[model samples]
Target: MSKIKIMKKFNFIIQSKGGAGKSFFTYLLGIKHEQNKETLFIDVDGSTSTSTNQLKFLEDQKRIGVIDLLDSQDRIARDRLFGSIEEIAELSYSNYILDFGAPESEQLPALFSRDVNQQELKGFAEFLNSEFIFHVIIAGGTAYGACMQYLTDIVRVVGEEFKIVVWMNENTLLNYPKQVEQILEAANALGLDVERFGDVLSGSVFDTKLSTIIQQGLGKAGIMKSGYMIQTQMKKLTAEIII
Candidate 1:
């Protein structure tokens, strides 16, 4: 068993409107934390729209996404799920991504319904408390404001320290083609310390190709506003901040 990397800095929450790239960005962030192995991803989207193609593509990349774990009723299964989350906190290898996407027709109603305190509900909450789960919300243009309010209410009930990420990742294969700058600028005004990254799915770079793109982009000025750029900035910026 690998030692899990317990997150030192609370949890990250990416909350946005429906089409704000929450689903894809969640996977990307989870991938970044893979080496920590203690990372967990809770889908909660229950979206059937892009499940077929997107998730399928992610699986092909050998990512440890958790959508397949939705049908376990065994106590051992629950135990495995719970233990895996905590176990990954100090480990190396990103096998700890948990997909919380339930069937939309089934679990989507729960989000709208008032508190039920069901057993499963309690278990899920327990899972979150034990695991420093990051909440990534998809904030589409029309759905942004309402989702923030809705998420605020939900997180209040859950009592988790989720860092809201307002993603402005474009879906086209150009990464940060000229138009994203304005969108990212607006996102920065939200007071959430927004982080924007290239929509890996929509970008032309893959694996080594992506690495080169990041290397070139990081050192530049104008084209460096993307999420990857911010991560680089965070490293340098935090180096002397000394928490």
Candidate 2:
């Protein structure tokens, strides 16, 4: 741990609907990064349950993996949640990527609830502010436009400082113009800090044998060519961050 560098902790402010590759992205993170026991994934998204099941089912056997960290909505009440998030920053780890619940995901409840008052929002914001890594990821589809607007509004009340990252998730398909535009429009409406917004790590990052499993699950085959494909824009962005 003494040999590792301590940088600001970051949370991936992630948003999306089911089947938009959130878990797939996390699986890739698992594939490439070193796993430290000190690290913790604060899964506000219940996707962890199903995603973990998928991972296990793929092996056709029992599996002991971090994917099981996903908690139910009822478990969100734990005080240790914030402590775990803080530890992710303080402990030795290269990065902490949090995959938040999708707007339509029923398992993970809403954050900006009418039932939950401002006091709760402030507490949540304070916890996130204290986190060494704080970030956000926006879903790219035009369908998710309203949801993005909702997140911007939520972050505004919570505080606009979360490290927001927009994932364009570009592929050959679609009547899509630009995913970035959707992200910008929503952020602009809520007056978020977007001067230096992060780049979309194109879907190509999911290139591995595990990715093949994902494609097969989706009833597709060999979606992305084999090889390492880095998101150049994000690589440069991260390099700027490193120095």
Name the best candidate (by lDDT).
2
Best by TM-score: 2
lDDT of 2 by residue, 108-185 (tens): 234334334446644564654444222333445644554455455556544443344434333311345565565567
lDDT of 1 by residue, 90-201 (tens): 3443334333442322232243234333345445545544333344443434554554454444444443333344434433314334444543554455434444454444
TM-score of every candidate: 0.41, 0.52
Candidate 2, run of 10 with poorest lDDT: 60-69
- lDDT of model number 2: 0.42
TM-score of 2: 0.52
